[model samples]
Target chain A: MNSSHLSLGDSEIRIRMLSQVYSASYLTRKKEREEKSKLLEQLYVHDVYDRIASDFEEQQYQPWPKVKDFLLGLESGSLVADVGCGNGHYLNVNPNISVIGVDRSFNLLRAAESRVPGVNCRADCVALPFRDNQFDAVLFIGVMHHLVSSERQVKALLELSRILRPGGTILLYTWAYEQQKRKFNGQDLLVPRYPSVGEDNPHCNCHRPTTKSSGDQLLTLPNQSQLSVLDKLERIFVRPFNLFINLFKLNSHGDSIETGESKDYINSVPSTQSDTLDDKSINLITKCSNSIYSNTLSHSDYHYDSMILVPKEFRVREFPASSLFSVSKVLNGKVSVHKRDCVSHSTNPARSRDDRFYHVFKRGELENLIKSSKSNLVVSKCYYTSGYWCATITKNTL
Target chain B: MKILTHNMLTSNIIKSVKDGYPLKIAATEVQEVDVDFNPEFIQRLLAKLNWSVICEAITQLDATKDIELPENLTDEVKEDEDMLRKIHHVLLEVEVIEGKLICPETGREFPINKGIPNMLLNDEEV
Candidate 1:
């Protein structure tokens, strides 16, 4: 389970894309799931929320006008879906909104469930088990594009449509075709709206007016297209967290996310269907994770370095390559949670490789991806990297 | 193989347009292969499927009773493998007997017949 951080703006986009989906964990055997839960409890939202609220405490995210205008127009008390709702970050940060947080990560949901208490947290997005027309509005924030294909993406969107009361909007924030390439934790997956891939401005530290009021000094955000995408996503998944401040109330005063040290979920909860992450899987994960780690841990990447068995015990061994290539073991890395959850304790030698990750292609290479994936019916607007901006197409157009 | 599974798979070429996955399946050669049902394997496959699409596909074949999902871990679900076996029949047992899978995003079509889908694209698609 990788808790990769996405840009706050893109977070809105990515969240919208998947709020309707659940983690893949619900589909696994009982024993494997429990182990994953233990690892996840460590990352529960109760913890991440407090940290984010504190870290970004200096600067709050004001709901964008487009999203605000849309929410304000909705029937005052409507049901909304918050896809990839991480610790109810959007809810606590914003105001006057209510949403059901749906995410694929257990640790994330634990935090969301705890932070927003009473909210539902199901796993997996691929096949949601909900009946038709169950919700009034489906809003996605920063998570849809991860679905990886048009057929699946369309099916997901259609599922959102099935669950929605007609006229309800699905909010979305996927990687625009022109946006830079994205990575989850460290794996590259031609994704949209990833963490700051090629952004020159992390923060301008400016302020703006939320449709209701003025004088809120917030970070000068990214472009309008990015903001507008979040607005459009409400048509698809959950309303922006900022849009419904009431629904995502938080306990802010450092309440332990866990209910008094219970590792009970440690053994039975199903984890999201991410790649099998045994040591070998982790080892394989490292090879495809990101190329930069190749240098520092060239030696540690090979040896029978580590063993990870919770999701199902698997050994991490060094994969070999050619002689001329200097790099012997092809895989050597660690899956980290914001790097703060360090794992140097393992007998394995290859330490965390966060700093090593870099953009796969220069501006030029990424640009080519965008240009190539483009077609007549699809209008893709890219930003940084040149990858194809993926959007589901209608049968009429296809 | 049923044309259903053919529609969802695209070859894993990681490069070129993302459309050519599991290779698209164009029609004309559709077949209903007879194979033994393995409920355990079907359950495992179900564990790995894009369920929504698979369900949509199964409906296209025989929209009989609503998909019979287990209400609980009943003997019907656990021991009788028929439920799983049918799922297997739909997912793996069936082939693109014929037809192509077109990328909704891209108009590229991969034709199939006799269970083998011809996903070969012109030099340009590559």
Candidate 2:
């Protein structure tokens, strides 16, 4: 699916906001719960990964040494499965062993195909396509946290056990709730990802907005005395990628960039729910954007072409008029970048549009899920390493 | 999809379906690529593979390239270098560039595009 479908119109946004929380009566029904969970999975985990696959790979990702060492130690010609193998980097960790990697996102699988051709496929963790007792070992890293619920986490563990040979083992890794850099208020959180929207620096181009105005320029943000606040807002929203530099300043300088009420907006606790964008500053931006969008309705030329700056697949994506308008406000004074310590703030994307869902596992959470699944997969080694909760579970021969 | 990977796939995940082993392959594009022939690796993997499934996949992919083998691995065949090399060729060298892995019991077809089988089922199917 292209990003066009994800561009929320006024009515759709309201509907989405209303449906964010399930009513107690609605939660009582099993079918509704299933539907809601599926929606959450699509909106947060599956779709976000697909959207960010290319940008995700561009960032330098060094293979975890412990995971690589485990793969290197495997016997030659051993059939291994790397479930949730993003970019398929581990497929060639040991040339002697054969590893068939699988992932949920087709785009990610495509990326993996580019790197390690003919070794990866598209498959879900909970419902794998392999037969019973198929693999000698399985690598299930950074996958369980995206399952969305405890039931799914347990279900995925059971599925891994089913495909593993009796004497084989599985190497699992997940994000830890207790982290040294970031403090999470709850187990579930949505982390932001900043994909370079266009080139590294949009200001490097000649169209870089300056006080010196010329009629020959492609864009004209002149200081026309008669122009209303909304008119100036439209021009800013038109070239919204420029707003990132200012957002970058806000993040680097901390509270210095914003002042007074805007500083309070920056200090306020970030909302945990992905759908809830009701922060005081965000509402103001949305209102400004919606107004500009309505005014531009009569004049088609004034419409912001987000396609010029964003990739074809991400054109008019989560950052439609509503979110784009907010970018201008964010640049104006209000800082809305969620204080996410888990991911490097250096590359944090606009939190309003590109939040990635994660369900951080607590201490013993992985063990509890395995035990509750009633599988013969016993935890061989469990420990915390480099701010992640990791475990190695072996299927019992008996 | 390689014959080695296909042998271990099943449609047993489908509702009410059991014994989904030996998925039928309808290959549109088949490519034979060179791989280092290791007789020992072939012999070691022979114990884990189902002989008939490999034969079935070979026939389905290209009937002209079929080579008959016994239902189970014999001591003589395991030791024969020529036979092991042929097994290695069929297992690793031959790849289905584009195809569909059809579930034998349910006729559920999983498409293989750019040589990677998309085994993901719809939410309702799961």
Which candidate number maximizes DockQ? 2
lDDT values for all models: 0.34, 0.62
Provide i-RMS per model in Å: 18.5, 1.5
Off by over 4 Å in 1: A1-69, A92-97, A180-398, B1-126
Query: Compared with the true structure, what per-residue lDDT tens digits does model 2 show for residues A79-139?
Result: 8999989878788888778888899888888877777667777888888888889789999
Query: Candidate 1 lDDT (Cα, whole model)?
Result: 0.34
Task: Name the Cα RMSD for model 2.
Answer: 16.8
By summed lDDT, which 10 consecutive residues of candidate 2 chain A come out lowest?
A203-212
lDDT of 1 by residue, A69-97 (tens): 55565553355566555445543332233
lDDT (0-100) at residue A220 of candidate 1? 17
Can you list each candidate's DockQ? Answer: 0.01, 0.50
lDDT of 1 by residue, B1-126 (tens): 342333334432223554333332334443455645545545533432345556545444433125554445444554565666656555544544435455544656544433333333332343
Looking at model 1, residue B39 earns an lDDT score of 54
Off by over 4 Å in 2: A1-28, A196-352, B67-71
